[model samples]
Target: MGKIVISSNVTLDGVVQDPDGAEGFALGGWFHRFAGSKDLEDWAARETAELLGVDALLLGRRTSEWFESRLRPGGGAEARVSPEWADRMNSIPKYVVSSTPEPPRWNNTTVLNGDAVKEISELERTVAGEILVYGSYQLVRTLLEQNLADELRLVVFPVVLGTGLRIFDETGGKPLRLVDTRQMGDGLAFHTYEFVRG
Candidate 1:
């Protein structure tokens, strides 16, 4: 089976929303504001390089909306990715799990609005390399409930958001095994964990 990897930039309190200042929320831009040190940038670049191994990207509706509004115009987060990085991203396929989206405008993107497991399984059979999930709290919750995710990669920033969307809000208990952990100079800690199945 193909591996399903999830990569996210979360706050110390697990908040993952508006890390890039796309939203007007005063609390939304924590990732860039508090974590823009050279050490953090270098670490993020390294992580981005590693995450590029995925054959495709899986995003949730909200994230897709935010990205589309800002990045699609060739500004904000989109601008952050250099031409080289953009070229690499454009080459990979993207699957957006959304119900209200009217198709994706980005190149090589597919909008999915059905059973998450079924769709992801189909993609796994056809796509090469790993399938990476980003900024989809809802999708990630479902994947965890269905026990579909193979690996979880979290980049925890040093700052704390008192309130926001969290990645581990799912009920019940799902066990995980730590595969690796590293501390970057920017005070961001990278944690890789594998779900421990029964």
Candidate 2:
């Protein structure tokens, strides 16, 4: 069985809305606000390390589209990251959870339609190794609620946005077992939690 891991960067307040600040959310871009800092570089290196071990990627349609626009080759953020990183991202298999009938246009992407939990559970059974999820807040909530996610790796930044879209917004009580915790840089906390499954 595959491990479904939700990996994301969140602020102190749990805000995961828009780290790049490209989105127009009132509190968006709290993540990139610390550009060029030693802490930020540490955080980026940490993310790169995680990506190195990732077998496949699971994302929401919107997040997938966002990556397509900003992380793809020739995209806005493409010029900033290493070419190896970009190539690895493009080579990995991506599964998008979307209700839309139109297929995702990104390379090596598959769309999962209908019944999120069931689809993901089947995905878990079929694929081996780590299936990392990034920036799919709603889908992450569902996975948490339904006990489908195996692990959650959160890179907690220092800033708190007071108010914005949070990852655990409406998620009910679910206990987690801390697998690992470490400080990446001066301000970032890297935590890994495993969902307590019966």
Candidate lDDT scores, in order, read: 0.78, 0.85
Model 1 worst lDDT run, 10 consecutive residues: 70-79
Please write out the lDDT profile of model 2 over residues 1-198, one tens digit for every residue: 899999988888888887877778887777768434777778767777788898899999998998788776567876567666677777889999999999778899999988888899999998989999998888888888888888999888888788888888898688899999998777788999998877
Which residue runs does candidate 1 get wrong by more than 4 Å?
none
Question: How does candidate 1 fare on TM-score?
Answer: 0.87
lDDT tens per residue, model 1, 153-188: 888888888988788876459788999998877577
Clashes of each: 0, 0
TM-score, each model?
0.87, 0.94
